[model samples]
Target: MTRLAYSALSSYSRVQIMRLVQDHPGRTITDLCDETGLHANTVREHVQRLIEGGYLVAETERRTTRGRPRVLYSAATGEAAASSPIARRKAEEAARRGDLMRRVLPWTADAELPSDALHQIDALVEDLGDAGFDPIIDEGALTVDLSPCPHASADGSHRDVLCAVHQGLMEGVLTQAGGPLRIAQITTSCDPSTCVVMLRR
Candidate 1:
């Protein structure tokens, strides 16, 4: 039997979700919530982080419903998700890749921000936290370190898309807050544990 260690590796909910998915590939988020007795939103957040970390895969489930499709998840490299648009469709540009990740990414049309630096920083932190980035803002340094990045990849190859989405999200929020700080460069780690964003005045 294989011995497993989980502490310091993942959050409690995330560990539970991954184990469940491994045991039951293609389990829907709702199914997982019921099994773990956790809230649906909590499960979804852990699942999203796992997916972003490349530890799990998410595919859409089809039903005759009018709203967003249900997502089925499994350990990474598991069987292709049944009816998954990403699994079925050809690879394309980041903007054109219509998937749940796109919808979750914190981005919208650009706007404006205030000249006051401190207020802008506070508002940006709130926005990022609401978006699940676990953000820590350093106004003196003009940088933010996001842990358990909801979009970073274990491999560096996908950083382009992941980093771009983060950049856009921050841009939108900062502009809306009336600070209009520009993104100087995004330093994504190959570790996939966190990513840092440096802002330009």
Candidate 2:
């Protein structure tokens, strides 16, 4: 941990909140409150301190519905990855990959492909690769192996939390891409070593 990171995470609540943000970035204040079991006022106070100290940064997301835009907070710690050029490159690649998936999924869903099996599998490979899952697809594309996970170490509560988030991201992409298709679940299983996502047509 950097001096700044250590200094900022000194408090128990701050550390808890920071860890939560690290696992789930772009979380709103209400999301943080629900996840951390912290009151909104208390979360806001701590979030303000984190922002001033450069441990976190806030972003304004455009509202999809008729309401005010929401503010999302993410970790801004200048840790090892933040300082390294290689790490930044990976992050950039991951962002582009994710964006591509977001763009392609809806279109894929709209394409009305004859082989949903093949097309969907192709999309998953591209999507997971761009997200830095380091994906390995078996011969039939029936099984996938994601080694060197996008996450550091999946342990404790985080193991389940991160896996669920990953699953949700993929599922969300599918839902957004395919308007009327209501296949809500993606079969995803993972351990600290690897994550395996099974695709069914």
**lDDT for model 2, on a 0 to 1 scale?**
0.54
TM-scores vs. true structure, each candidate: 0.39, 0.41
Q: Candidate 1: list runs displaced more than 4 Å.
A: 1-115, 153-159
Deviation of model 1 at 75, angstroms: 33
Could you tell me which 10 consecutive residues in candidate 1 have the lowest summed lDDT? 86-95
Tens digit of per-residue lDDT, candidate 1, span 65-173: 6888877786643123322232112112122322333356635212243324444455456546545578776655678888778655434664454454345445544
Residue pairs with backbone atoms closer than 3 Å in model 1 (clashes):
112-175, 113-178, 113-179, 114-178, 114-179
Overall lDDT per candidate, in order of appearance = 0.54, 0.54
Clashes of each: 5, 1
RMSD versus native structure for model 1: 15.1
- Candidate with maximal TM-score: 2
Please write out the lDDT profile of model 2 over residues 1-201, one tens digit for every residue: 112222443355765676677677788999989988989999998888666444566778878799889998876533432122322333344445545664878543323333333344454454465455677765244566776576645346665555554564454333323322223344544446655666544
